[model samples]
Each structure stands twice: as structure tokens, then as C-alpha cells.
Target: MQNLQSFASAMSRRLLREAGNLPALSGNDFASSKEIQRPLDVLSQGSGSFSAFPKSNEQITTPSLPESAENVNAANQLSAPVTQSADKESSGSKYSNWIFVLIFPAAILLILVPILVCRKRGNASMGPWRTGLSGQLQKAFVTGVPKLNRPELEAACEDFSNILNTFPTCTVFKGTLSSGVEICVVSTSISSIKDWPRSAETLFRKKIDTLSRVNHKNFVNLIGYCIENQPFMRMMVFEYAPNGTLSDHLHVKVYEHLDWAARMRIIMGMAYCLQYMHHELDPPVAVNDMRSDAIFLTDDYAAKIADVGVWKELADKAKATKEDGSSRSVSPPDLAGNVFCFGALLIEIISGKLPETNDPDCICIWAEEHLKAKSYSTLVDTSLQDHQADELEAICEVIQGCTDPDPMQRPQMRDVTSKLKAILAITPEGAGPRLSPLWWAELELLSMKSN
Candidate 1:
């Protein structure tokens, strides 16, 4: 009994010393110490007094107790690292979140800054029109319509002071390129167009696109275009026609009078052009200004139409429509209007008189009456000689059909082309040798074949 008490006292003192050295105790440790004290106090009270140590040792004991302070200390040591590991994991997750938040925006800035730098550089090189004329127009200028440098064009056209002819909408300037090829530069003042300050690029792009697609021998060749700033200008470059316009030859007498064969060829070419524009092209093109003045003559008197698909009138019409709030979109060019004008052109060609000089409405009427009376001479140009009567009658018949007031009553250009071809076949060449002897010989052979 004495040995047991001594052993208990020594064990209790050692446990108390260790508990005092501990840095701090958790709530669980404090509660566990209290639980040990209840049993120890019960024993101490029951035994009438054991030795009291410090306050920490007072709460716990070892030797006589089955649940010892030493065992609780061992369990606390095992559990301490696990709680610290959970705290470390939580701190690591927070640190990773901060890194991600910082890195994402930095990555975005790295991507965006270079693009902005490149865009600034590009704007510096290409000028103000670069952004306005990007995408399809930029691609078109590169691949389809050659973009002539404005400075080079200015030098060629003598700073555009060498004017060839002036019209209400545009001015023509004759220039010889550096390569010694003669070119006609047509300049239209876009400054006059409504809302041009805002829509200059779009208007020019649309106009140039319309002009560029006309690929035919009978239409003036679109060589290139120029757009410049600081006294801004928009110009189209064309192959210069040495013989000038049909109006120059026929009305103004700038050149010698056209012979019967030449007139026939011009008529035939104009017919074919109408056919090509009105039927052959996917979306049929309409000529806004279909006058004799619009026709150019090559060195060989081959008729090539100028300003075939370009007009400021379209923009004006669109502006008018917009002002009235009548339409959000521009209406398509009136193909029937061209048909009516073509009839007037045919009348002008035959009579050698301006339809505008006579009653424009009555011009078709009188020409039709002359055709009906078989008075072909009255309808024929006084300048034209040796033209076949059948050819005149046939052409006047086409004019009558074209000039019908009702648009639906007018014949398609395809049909007009066919009729003109039939007339051309029957009519013999006058004043010039036949165009192709072999072709003519074949025609003669075919004529001999059937009724």
C-alpha cells in the first residue's frame, strides 16, 4: 500500500511538469483535463488527501487512473498535425485563386495590346479611308480593280488641269500614262453627294464596283481608279478613244460624217450592248444616261459606250426617297426606262436630229407614221446614203416596239437584238469593204441554202 502511493505521487508530478511546458491547449485538451480532474478529485477526497501540485497537474493524473493524461497527450500529438494540414490546404487554395485572378487579365492584355499596336501602324500607313474601305472593298481593290496611286494619276493628268470635256456630273481629262498609253480620266465630284462626308467610301465603292464589272469590247475599258484626300477626288481611268463620242461625230461634226456601213455597225453594236446588259448579266444592268453622247468611237469607228452603269442620279433618287421616308432601300435601276431611251436613240440615229429638239413624245409617233406610209426616205438621215429600205423599215419597227407607253408592251432587248441581227444579215455593207471576207462568204453560202 505504501509503495503504490509513492509511485502515484511520482507519476502525477511528471505529468504536471509536462503539462506546464505545453505552449497552449485546445478546447478539447481543456475539457479532457477537467474530465480527468473529476476522477482524481473523487479519489483525493475519498482518500482524505493526496499531494496537491500546480493548477495544471491538479486537473490531471496518471498512475491509478486507467485513462491517463499521458495517453490524452499522445492522442493530442496525433490530431494536431491533421488540423494544421487542413489549415495549410485552405491557405494554398486561396493563394492559387489570387494567382489566377492576376494572370487572366494579364494574358488578355498581352493578346489585345499587340493587335492595337498593329492597327495603329496600319492606319498610319494606309490613311483615313483604310478603316472605312476595309473588308470586301479592300479585297476588291487588291484583286479586281487596280488601285492607281493618286500622285501618279495627278502627274499623268497634269494635276487634272488638262480637261477634255465637261458634263454636269463629271469631267473627262485626257492623259498619257508613264507607259505612253493614252488614258481618259473621268472625275466626278463626290463632295456634292448628300451625306458624302459620312458615306464617301461607300458611295465610291458602289460606283466603282458597278463600272468595273462591265467587260465588253463595246464598253470603255476600266483600267483603274484613284481616290485622294486634301482636295479629295474620285477618278476612273479609261482607255482613251481617239475619235471621241458619237455625239461629236453626228451632231457637233467634230469628225467626218459617219457612212451608212459605220452607222449600221454602230447600231448593231449598241443593240448587242443593250442585250448583254439587259439579259446576259446575272443581275441586268440599266444605263442611266443612254444618250448618243455616252457612245465613244474607237480609231476604227467601233462604238464603245461610256458611263454604261454609273450615274449620280441614282444617289439623288435614293436621297429623295429617304427624305420622304418612302423606302429604306434604293429601288433597282429601271430597265424599261432604258428601253424607252434606246427607242429615242434609234430615232436620233435614223433621223440625224436630236430627239430633244423635236417633241420627245411625238418623235416616236412621227417616225412610226413614216414607217407605216412606207416613206422610208423621210425617216432616213440626210447624212446617210445608200442604206437599204428594208433595213430602215425593220429598225423603225423595233423603235415603235421599244417606245410603247406600257412597259409590258415593250420587247426585251434579247428580242430587239435578234431583230437587229436579221436586218444586218439582209443588208449589204455600204462605203466600206466587208468586215470578214470568210464570214461573208459563209453567209453567202448559207443564203443560197434555203427559202
Candidate 2:
């Protein structure tokens, strides 16, 4: 019984040893298996749950889902940062684009308004004088007397009185002043007259009387005068020159048909008139307004000095004088300076061109330069080409003398008139008609007299 019991104990101890060896083998198999980590397993077991190993072909062949999941998570983390950066860059670009669209057109409108307003105001101020033909006719009709004869002057005064009764608007008259006698009349409206201050009116009337007494053929004939008691108006009576102003013949675009003989006659007459005013008339009248428009022409083409009384009148008005007296407003040297203005007038008459303030080639300056260069041929009016060369040269010389810039160098009006007469006396009579091409071609069909 003791031997059998010892055998059972030995068997039990072998079984126990075998069981321990099998458990160690299973542990080795487990260690050889491919390792993979799950996110949850990692969190539960900590970083120590994963083991580092050299990969064999068998381990590489195993499904790598857990490793793929780890790679996918890493890739997603990196892509998220890239997308966030891209979104910020896109947002920054959009904001920059939005700011540029708002600021460019507002700057242009603020700069153009004032320039338009000034131009509008300037145009408006010139409206009265620049009004059309009807307005100009109204102004002319209301300002001066129409041409009349001595018998007609008498009839006109009677008619004027009758007209005044019918039209009270016609209150002023343009008529003759005969040795302090005021008679003969052509009437104008009191309201139609341009406003002149009371001081100006009294002064002008006195000077007009002085001018009216001067008797010369070339001087405008003032027969009589009167001033009615209206606030800003005055009237004068004078012999009217029927042929209109010298400027009409000199520069009229459609009606400029003065022949060479007529022009020469007119120029001579003008020279004589200027001479008489400057040398013969007592107190040496200075023609301050020497424009061609102030020169009147008779039916015989004789030049009569109109508005000779205007300068003295203006001077008196400026001085606030009322008494009828001859006052020398301009000095002798200044009166001589009027010769320069006369030269400009001559240029306007000779050439049909007006003096422009802007042109460097103004008529007087051009003529003087040409004269200095001995190119007198250039001074002849292009329309006067048919005129005798010697006569033209003489006229040019006279014009140059009159227009001299230095007042001291200008010839006296008496000398100018004497020279003009000599030239006229020598000029052949009845020269063939020389006409302005601009007027001649159009008016050829009409049988009007060349003069």
C-alpha cells in the first residue's frame, strides 16, 4: 500500500511540470504575433500597450487596419491645418478686393461745378448790348436825328411838336443852335436816353454849346440846341449828313463800294477837317473819340467830323462843370498824341480790317515796320490796287507820319492836310472804279452808282 501511494505522488508532480511548460510556449506565441494598437486600447492601456518590433514578411502580410486608421488620423490632422490656412488667405483676399470698389468715382464730381457757373454769369452780363438787330435799331432810332434840309428842319420842328403831343415819349430833340438860339428839332424819348448823372448832363450841355459855335465846312454843323427838364436826358439840333458815317464806306461788308477817287476825296476831306480842328479852331479841339464811326460823310462824299463836340462834353461831364465855358481838359502834348490814334483810324479806313487787341501784327505796328523796311507797296490797300503808285506812296507816308509812336515825331494836322491836298491836286481825275471783290461780285447785277 505504501509503494502505490508514492507512484501517485510522482505522477501528479510530472503533470504539473508539463502544464507549466505548455503555458510558457503559449506566451512565446503571443509575443511573436503582429502588434496593432487601437485608439481606445491605447487610452485604456497607456503608451506602454504598443511594442516596437522589426517587421517580417508574415507581419507585413497581416491586415493593417489599425495602422491605416492611425495614418488616416494623422493625414486628417495635417489637412485640417492646411484648410484653415487656405480659408484665412481666401478671406484676406476677399476683404482687400471689397475696399477698392468704394473710393474712385467720388473724387471726380467735386472738381467741375464752379467753372460752369462763371461762364454763365459772363454771358448774362453782355445781354443788353449783345441783343439782336431789333434791339440795335431801337437804340439807334431813339438816340439821334435823321438827316434833314433847312426847309425840312423847319418842317421837322413843327412835326416834332405835333409828334410830341401824340407821343409824349419823344421828349428830346436833335436840332440846330444858331448863335445861342435853339430851334429846329428831331425828337427822341426821355426814357430811351441812356442815364447820365445830373452833374454829367449840365457839363455836357455847356461844352456842346461851345462846339456848336465853331464854324467850319468839315466840322459837323450845329444849328441849334435845347435841354428839356427831364431827369437824365438832353437834346441838340444839327445838320445831318445824308451819306452816313465814313466807317460805312470803309468797312461795310456788303455795302463797301467806295471807288479809289471817292476814297481819296474822303481821305483828303478828313485830313482837312482834322487840320482845321487842330490848328484853325480856337483852343485846338482834341478829337478824343477818333474812331471811323465818328466821321460823317456828305452826299458828295465830303468827310464831315461828327461828334467833334463829344470829347469836350465828356471832359466837362467828368469835371462836374455846369457853366458854358471852354476848358482845356487835355494838354497840348496829349492833343498831339491824338495823331497816333488818327493813324490807327487811317489804317482801318485803308484796310477793311479792324484792329484786334490780341494780334501781334496790329495794323499800325505792321504798317510802321513795313515803312521802315521801305516796303511801301505792302501799305497800299489791297482794294486800292488800281490806284497810282506815287499817290499811294504819298498817302502811306502821311499815314506813317500821323501814326508815329513818338508824339513829337508826328506831323501837325495842317501839314498832313496840305500834303493830302497836293497829292489830290496831282491825282488824275475820274480814275476807273476800283471795287472791293467781296462786294463787287455780289452787287454787279445792281446798277447803283460806284461811289
The superposed Cα distance between candidate 1 and the true structure at residue 245, in angstroms, equals 1.3
Backbone clash total for model 2 is: 10
Q: Name the top lDDT candidate.
A: 1
- Per-residue lDDT for 209-235 in model 2, tens only? 445434455555444344544433344
Model 1 TM-score, all chains together: 0.59
The true-versus-predicted C-alpha distance at residue 289 of model 2, in Å, is 0.6
**What are the lDDT scores of the predictions, listed in order?**
0.63, 0.50
Q: What are the candidates' C-alpha RMSDs?
A: 22.5, 32.4
Alpha carbon lDDT at 29, candidate 2: 38
